[model samples]
Target: MLIDWFTVGAQALNFLILVWLMKRFLYKPILHAIDEREKRIVAELANADAKKAEAQKESNEFQHKNEEFDQQRAALLSKATDEAKAERQRLLDEARKAAVALSFKRQETLRNDAHNLNQAIRRKTQQEVFAIARKALMDLAATSLEERMSEVFTRRLREMDDTIKEGLADALKTASDPVLVRSAFDLPAEQRTAIQNAINETFSAEIHVRFETAPDLISGIELTTNGQKVAWSIADYLTSMEKGVDEILKEKDKPIAKDEPKPEEPKPETKS
Candidate 1:
């Protein structure tokens, strides 16, 4: 290499100028573009991250809402099932009550019918018995029954106790109206006189007497004064018979006991 200072200095100045030009126009512009690109990339990355976070939040909200909807559906289904069970039980109870009421009503109807039938039978029987008894008595009246009844009445009057005699005497004394004497048949003149004499002798008073025919007496004599009455009649015997008959019929109509033994029949005697 030639030792030329002038050439060296000139070449060095040229190299320095080239370096400055490259730095100002090419290198600085390239470096600035690279920094801007990096900043844009960073901004895009931040935006993407934000979007991902928002999506995740939305997914979480949707999942929570779905869970709430499922819970609401389950609650509704359970409530409906409970209501159905309650309704079914109510219907069953109502049906049972109705059945009980119907059974009671049927029993009541049966009892009423039985009672009405028994009453009707009793009334019919009583009427028939009374008719038969009256017919028999009326037939007996065609005989000397009236005369015998008069004799019996006189005897009864004679046999009256002191108490009865005193009561009749007091009634006669206090009575404003005449004493009424009722008989089933027209009394003979002798019988009337005898009755009057007996009354006067028994009471020792001049008591007025009024005789009346009463067919309903059925073979008896009845004496009434004020509210007091003294009577003797065949009807009394008939009433007793009727009562006995009623008791017998009631016993016959009673239900037999299941555990009671039946009566044994009488055995026929064997020829020796």
Candidate 2:
């Protein structure tokens, strides 16, 4: 076991050279490859994280859009409901107005029919009554009552109101033409004299007179002077008759009311 320094030193130097060579070629290259692989893995993980974030953002946007669509749909539904209600009310109002108009038209037609019937009745009555009055007066004109008629005429003339008397007096006194005394029949000489005397006594003035027979006078007497006239005709009696007929017609047109309510008849009992 004697020590040999040269051989040991030579062997140690050779081992050191081998270690350097291995470190420079094998260890350094392998470590560099591992670092490169780790860097690549880290970059891949970062890319995956970015993709995840983008997907999350897109999901949130889709949810927000869905919510907005729901709100718009609800608003549209509400609007449609409101419009339907308004349309229904409008139709009801139109129907009500149409019904009212129809009722008014019915009432108006009824009133017109009643008025026409009443007028027809009035016209028929007037024509018949006036014709009868005219015939009766014409028949009466053939009688021998000239003196009495003259006396009646003078009496009527005297019965005028104060204002009428004054007017007649002025007309008679100032008239340039003679006063006219018309009758349905001729008068005798004594009757004419009596009438003249009555006129003078009633008016307290001398008035010129003219006598004439007028068949159209209808058994009446009339005096005319300066466009003023005093007359009595069968028309007076007809006026009274007309008034009586009007009262009767009014009574007939009135609805007769029952003093008591009408009793509802009892229904016959069934044997069952």
- Candidate 2 residues 109-185, lDDT tens each? 86677567555655565556555644665577653445556767778877878898888899987899998988877
Pairs of residues at least 3 apart in sequence or in different chains that clash in candidate 2: none
Per-prediction TM-score to the true structure, in the order listed: 0.44, 0.40
Off by over 4 Å in 1: 1-143, 255-272
Q: Which candidate is the best by lDDT?
A: 1
Each model's RMSD to truth, in Å?
11.4, 11.3
Model 1, residue 48: displacement in angstroms?
46
Q: Cα miss at 262, model 1 (Å)?
A: 12
